[model samples]
Target: MGGEGENTAVDLTAGDPADVENDNDRIITEEFKIWKKNTPFLYDIVMSHSLEWPSLTVQWLPDVSSLPDKDYETHKLILGTHTEQNEQNYLMIATVNLPKEDTEIDARKYDDERDEVGGFGGVDNKIEISVKLNHEGEVNRARYMPQNPFVIATKGPHADVCVFDVSRHPSVPANNTVRPEHRCTGHTKEGFGLAWNPHKEGGLLSGSEDMVVCYWDLKEAGKTVAATRQWKGHTAIVSDVAWHCSKPTLFGSVGDDKQLLIWDLDEAKDAPVFAVPNAHEREINCLAFAPHSEFLLATGSNDRTVALWDMRNLSQKLHSLEGHRGDVFQVQWCPLDETVLASCSSDRRVHVWDMARIGEEQDEEDREDGPPELLFIHGGHTARVEDFSWNPNMERTIASVSMDNVLQVWQVADNVFNEGNEDEEEPADDDLE
Candidate 1:
């Protein structure tokens, strides 16, 4: 696959070892500058805030705060930390400052009066902790109950999910500690899979490395919550789980077993109602159902590919998206765009895609930019993108957190998705499996 000398040479191994040694620092600085200069061309607005430590997950609070005198809007974030053994880990709430909804939006910039000499590296970003709770262990994952945003749940300390009414504590510093009011315990090992049923109040689902999924009813239970039911069909660790947006009894999961399964609580708990074995060439890391189109599903995997599948036909995938060179960690359908979705990966990139643009004609530049459906590629983070979510309250907005402890909140350029394109029909739903 190597090309000629003009751009050829696969790597640095072609010359004398010492002379060929790559200067990573030099390369990184150069790359950051180039990307920052191009950001304004790609983003409508962007904010890059760094945290005290990297969070394994990030979620937007349902509400946004607007102050009369300020030029920016304030948004609260739900986050969890991963720290060294000797350090204290926490479930945290942080507030970010953003330019008030679209009066004026710009791109990444640089100033000599910065931390790094070439610092567009989170320089203009501002964020601060609003509240922090002492977690029993590193937070594996965190989610706010959909129906009631004030109620939050965190997974950690070996298969336990702690439920907290976050409103109980005032907006205090990280030191003024509060504890979870209830805890759900059952699985034998730790997991990153945790979700709340959107249509059902107090309904929670958690899966673990123990190859089991537990359904917890947190409403009537006391301090220590127990699973009302458990499912045991997965042969390996369950990587992620999701509850259907409109169906209270419907849910889905993907796992290291290379399987995608659909579950209905109204049916037998011991077996999945439908499953697609080998839905991916490698184990699936995460799956999300399209919120607007109930029949469509998106999945990311160790295969470095993102697959779109129609639940009605599991025998083959509708599209196999190829670009990421590393394992994809999270794949989420945007709340505001029915045909749009985003995926984060171990390759240190966050890619936004649009299904409606698939197979479209492209110019030379567009042809070189991966796939036509790959709307945008955010290569801002210096480390693996751990997690990301679309802003529930804004258009084309996304918040992504990374292993480098950076949290970027950016909105795609309106023209990126809307230019010259009329609204197309929502993906056909005649085939809801």
Candidate 2:
């Protein structure tokens, strides 16, 4: 079945060592002649770039607390060119000066901890490092890459955090570089979520696709491995997990079974705080808590609806805002504004909804068909909107990632980061996916 050209003439395109060496010899001779003719200038230019290759993109994260009178740095983009690569995925943290101007919203007060070794990096697997951006906003760089990084969750130094790494290899694929790095038995299934405990020292929680949520303690040994307690309830795949910002004892998970299960990290109990079956009509793709409200939660689904629920009053639907005809992939509430919720859908639309205005105008005219009107429908992605994040440090800044391999930063309005009292505005009708 071999082609006739494969064994015959010198294949210039093939990567054979003999052929490549010959080609390099010929090119080197021609380059040497040109370099001799160019003289001193060629030597200087050739010696200039001896360090590293040029990167595709460069960016700086914004400082937030330095901004005047902002309670939370929701307007600042703390992560610069924050990319999550499939092969070498890393949470890169960088530090730089903020733009200086009168209207300049640079909050550099938190720049003292610009030290590395706090961000996460891993090769060939979804190994999330539980590192945080220091005050100066830099990542933790090591001489050699760390190993057995299963699920990382940050706590005070000494021994703090958890992470999961590839423990087994199935078969060598076309991409030979992506082989599994290790073989170990830690969790029952692959880890899906990691969160640091805000109240306790070296306390954290990790969830796996195995439908188990484990409480971990890393206060003993540096980079330790162990679980104190495990909580189980769901019979399906657990997709995501998150700790309640204020409630350290409680955490949440959304899964493939289209259910939302709330787990209490405290070992005093063996069951969930609350289990809501049929939470989403479809698979729950993403879930986020209201950064400012403890009783409020948001969930996105493949059903194209972003549901807002009030733990206080769940007798009926609080607000089921449906605009995207495709799956609503991810959702997050503004850290500074509990009423502002952002959702990215497979329909390629990133919508920002003002939950404070939900059912606020439920008159006979407006409630004829749908719920509250859309606050803003963000556009730009040429393909499905995979993920988007609102900067926790700046004002009204949002960054989104798409399947087109592009990331976009959009400023919604001038210092209007918390539009709690603004009138709801309906965007123009445009059917684009």
Candidate 3:
């Protein structure tokens, strides 16, 4: 070592890389134990389930049920597999039971009943496969029809998509091939983007590497046909498409060409009404229109950052969020809070951003961190977070899936999101000292 800070960097050339990796694993394992031990203090309701195979996408269903007289509630979720084995791959509806309240088994006291990785789920609350239908291709993404939750749309590796009426399948879990209710075929190459119109019934949108976004009108009952319209607005791969929450004819798409195009079907079918070129520094992986505010949108990029935009004025970004070390995979606005947003990344973290907190004062420790609007960073996953979904029925709750075969559901601890959690109330002007 040299004097002062001259040789502060560790000499990595001297040690065996395998030993270093093992040490890192040991540290991570122990850190997980501590994180699980403090679960009660970190979440309103948290549960982690290790899956048999990795799922690439997840969405919460509208259905919720409870066992006879039991205080536990079971929530339905739709997820799809990405396995190479065609027989093993499926679009499935799974159920996870929740307690009447937060977990009662304190890990600090009764840590004996824990799994090898430190999860505390038992038989009552364990995840169960409710229905699984054979899928012909890898499910890159999946979404349920807003008006018809039983109907699910899945995007494949190519310009292929399968629509399944899950209600027609067996209610119980089984491994068997099931034909799709309909198929939407368009495009000439691969793509992993899919979206169902929230404002229009039987309306769907699919985008692929062919650089065209196709619209499907699935109102023919049992018969399915090719795309009714193809919007060629991008010169590269269309990564995603999102429908405006209230505007049936209005939608937006992001692509590899670094453009965010807003399409108005009422005006034109082939060209966008508004386009924001170079919306992100790199390929825009995903985009989401604010659930409550129609003019606000958020996008995540390959540049490892998330950007907030006002659709009314795209001259410049409203905010550029930087925290993730890997590419931002997806960005979504919380339905319960118009100003709140969430982004997941390949860096194995999910960040919760509160736009309302921007420009607010912060303590010394928070000032040393990144942005004041950074509400919380969730680092519970061990691998790259593939996808995540917010629970519309629950406040501040979200579920995420990772590459390492883990599905976790958690809600932020109230003190972090609730302003009433302040330790002491400031007196009004009349009562001020």
Candidate 4:
């Protein structure tokens, strides 16, 4: 894996040989089959896109209405770059257009055989829409509004949070007429993390190096932007923040101070409802609240460990997962499954975990020392993976961005594990010998 400081040229259209089944594909295919045979799930690399610059964040837009008379949906991806070159920090919106005829054929094939190998082939054609922001700062994070697909929010090594309106010019080559619609400046230092309130129409939250969190209401537009409320609690820089999916007034933040703080808008503005000090041995990098459970939370740290917590019991952690050889950068829960989650790390691997199996194991104190139960490990990136996103509408599909300047999309194969096979025994040693 390469360091973050390495600079690379823009190569947006080049495709990886492994993405489509080339010479190196045989090894990957065999390994994938073996892994799927032993595990309960399977995955395949469906698409790969090269970038001109390294990206620290990638986000998938919400599902949109299909084009008129077309049976396939048009999906879009937003990539935020991190670079030292002047004006190299850009935001790109890549649209994947699948032909209806090819999609129908693939669907029919999958329905007939239902094999792990059969599905729509990798996407070879896509349209790229890009824009250069006014500030030449590293983009640490980017996210789309829950209610509006056209609106996006980004923050980085700048004091202000930038908002872009993609509808201004859907097809890019942006001119002076199309620019960032708003710049919300309140933080005294560079911003690190950002999250949109899932339940609020125009509410947003941002964490910064200034050790403060600011809340903004974008519902009202004006010449200048200001935070509706701001709070300070952490003694160190805040690394990430996330809003609860079902609770509009609740949110969480993790920081370099090794603390996880939970805030509520309806309560006192100055203090948090629950503060878990020393959440990890090292700086906490990122966190996400479970989509299905309001009390469940997950956090990753520089200590190379991920911990799951129950908000109802702040004193004890539900589980501590350790497998990544390097720092854990991001963790996300599957939108469709309550017991599944995924994580990316500086070790250049993406791992998927099944909490149902983990819950059946003995507690950390009683169990012997060994790696946690990991369902799958994706070793496709040549460099450290910085961020990844799960598709909201698709089951077992995910997209990840890496410092190698590549974007890869992976999807789990259907019916890899046969029903009622959990009780089967392995072959005898004499048979293998």
Candidate 5:
């Protein structure tokens, strides 16, 4: 009896393991099951709620209005880029933060009335710049459209980018922001590409679908206006342009003629410093430079391949990445990771590759062993993927835009295999009892 007495345990409650199982089953049924199946992660994240937010195009703008010196929290503005039958561009903007604790109705009510309370949405003043396309096929001029809170980007503050709406202005106030006051006369044809000079303030470049690249110097003279520089090149529609982050006057453009044109804005007549001919097998859609690797440049093309070129030895191709079946749309290198590059294609697939190992000295025989490893294939979109952007501040976050008119933000895990499976519940260790 004495030995057996030591084995005794207390059953202080009416509930047994069966009851525990039943309680958990009810709990999961009522609370966890729906969320576990639909939500992206066990915990809350920006992408946890749903994937219906279509439109791969998004920009992360930090709240610089506060403190002026210290960077505030970043917010993502997601929207679609499409021209409808009414000739109106419709877009939805969603502010991305952590999933909120507020109820759906409460959230809706808050958003609807946010501006009235002088909250984040209350700021009615947005910097507006207008781009005018002329018969000569150039962004003839860009001007600031006057409105309250509309400040011209001159010496200190600068507008991030200049956007064009194919659709004319609507009668509604909400729609008024979408309309251009004066018909921008610059590009002879519709400009396909618009980029702000990362180096020079108010300096912008626009590429025409008609095979011409124009530079615009935006200045303040009563009107928000942009003037074109004499610099012009590319025999075909310039599909993409990339500016050296540090070099203000230096930028490169890729055209349908399968050429890469590099320029120095200061030396307008000197021609491109380096012109890579036949850089792609087909039309090039986009180009990007490694954030750290100045000598490295990446281009995506209609030939379904992305080629990485080493500027030091441009005479030969560095690495030709192949896998995309359809035309490669956009390629972006991770701002921080030298080895990783992300590419999206008309095939509706986003592929990431690690090419740091593909060093210049690697022998052809060794390379025959294999190319860089394919990291992941994201396949959620149903239409041609148009553009994908990487957040400079966030790790493993990428935003992609597609012809489907949806913007998606994907948080790629470094270890895709380690993702938690919320479907199956693990039983507690019996011995612990």
Candidate 6:
């Protein structure tokens, strides 16, 4: 692989100043002002990079210690990509240096400057290192352990999941014979998703096409991999899996069987604590748990919709968000805000939804039973967007990867509805069954 550096600037001006006094310009400017007044949220692409191979998955480093201490900063990210020429897959780690301000500024100050005269200066981004892995099939998912950022776990078209150590060096091995520290093999078919336990170290979860969720313990030193537990609850291929943010023993999985299963490690063997049969009309493709809530969860499905579920009640959904023109591939809850969610789909659009209005009463005339409120729509990718990740340490910052062979990092403005809104009450813990 090769490395290159580029500096790109963002233009946020509503219109040109040269035509500010013309009649036609006045009409256009007025229309633009009206539009801006109606639009609640805005986003600007801060950094973009075109990779040689189509990126399948991208993730921000869990720890921000490597970044500079400043109000606005930059950090590192890892990506998984595949080449059609050699049919080989590789892992890339990059150091992205975003534009920064000289002095500390509040959100209002930043917004005023951005709206008046475009955004901050250019961004400095380049690849730090690229290493080839020993995977013969395409890599579907890659993630870093929350407590152990140096260790990464990857799963894909093969049944086995590979764990690598990046603490030694970021580049390829000097001897060109680098192998994974651990090779976890248990599933009978290709793996589709991988997630690391957030509250515990050395705990990893993998969901596969074989309809099983395998948990691995990498703390064991002598063994290549220690398979501690495996759960078989889905009747079809398991598409995705996610561990609860605050619950150490709780995790959720979605599958082609159109079911969302919640499993607890302390429960009985091979059975879920709760199962939502027919969670969607079509196959469920992805799942994410709210970062701050104990019971809020989100699921994306092939039916071109995203659904919010209150785990306390399994019989009904909290909200159904419909906007994607194609199958929804990924859904993620914002780590900073419990009421915000992000999703991407095969339609090449990345949508951010403000879910605070889910239970609010609407005026009869204004409410035609429309879908959930969309905060922002991002459409820069030329091809299908496969996956995206939110930076846990940053507010409203997200990075998305696509089949267009590009990775884009951007930030969304705060929601307009959040200015003077009161917190919504949580649902009662009454059982829905």
**Each prediction's TM-score versus the true structure:** 0.87, 0.58, 0.87, 0.79, 0.63, 0.78
How far is each candidate from the true structure, as Cα RMSD in Å?
A: 7.0, 17.3, 6.8, 8.7, 15.9, 11.0
| lDDT of residue 20 for candidate 1 | 54
Q: Between prediction 2 and prediction 6, which has the larger TM-score?
A: 6
Cα lDDT tens digits for candidate 2, 284-324: 86777777888888888888898877766644447788877
lDDT against true structure, model 1: 0.78
lDDT of 6 by residue, 113-185 (tens): 2332113433223333345454455667888887888888887667888888777554754543537778887
For lDDT, the strongest prediction is 1
lDDT for each candidate structure: 0.78, 0.48, 0.77, 0.72, 0.51, 0.71
Q: Compare candidates 2 and 4 on lDDT and give the better one.
A: 4
Candidate 3 pairs with clashing backbones:
none
Candidate 2 Cα misplacement greater than 4 A, ranges: 1-89, 94-101, 104-186, 313-316, 360-373, 415-433
Task: Give residue 280's lDDT in candidate 2 (0 to 100).
Answer: 79
| Candidate 1 wrongly placed segments (more than 4 Å) | 1-28, 106-125, 173-178, 363-365, 421-433
Instruction: Please give the range of 10 consecutive residues that has the lowest summed lDDT in model 2.
Output: 42-51
lDDT per residue, candidate 4, 1-433, as tens digits?
0111111223323477555345334443444344334222233224556777888998888864466655556677778778765554666677655334335323222121222222444433543544444334777888989889778888877788888876774454544342578888789988668999988877989999999999989988664589888989899998899999889999999999999999998886579999999999999989999999989999999999989999999887888888676799999998877888988999777877767767455557323323435655665566789999987766677789999788877665433211125664433223211
Candidate No. with top TM-score = 1
**Candidate with more favorable, higher TM-score: 3 or 6:** 3
lDDT (0-100) at residue 362 of candidate 4? Answer: 51
Which pairs clash (backbone N, Cα, C closer than 3 Å) in model 1? none
Worst 10 residues of 6 by lDDT: 1-10
Per-candidate clashes, comma-separated: 0, 25, 0, 1, 31, 0
Model 4 error, position 267 (Å): 1.8
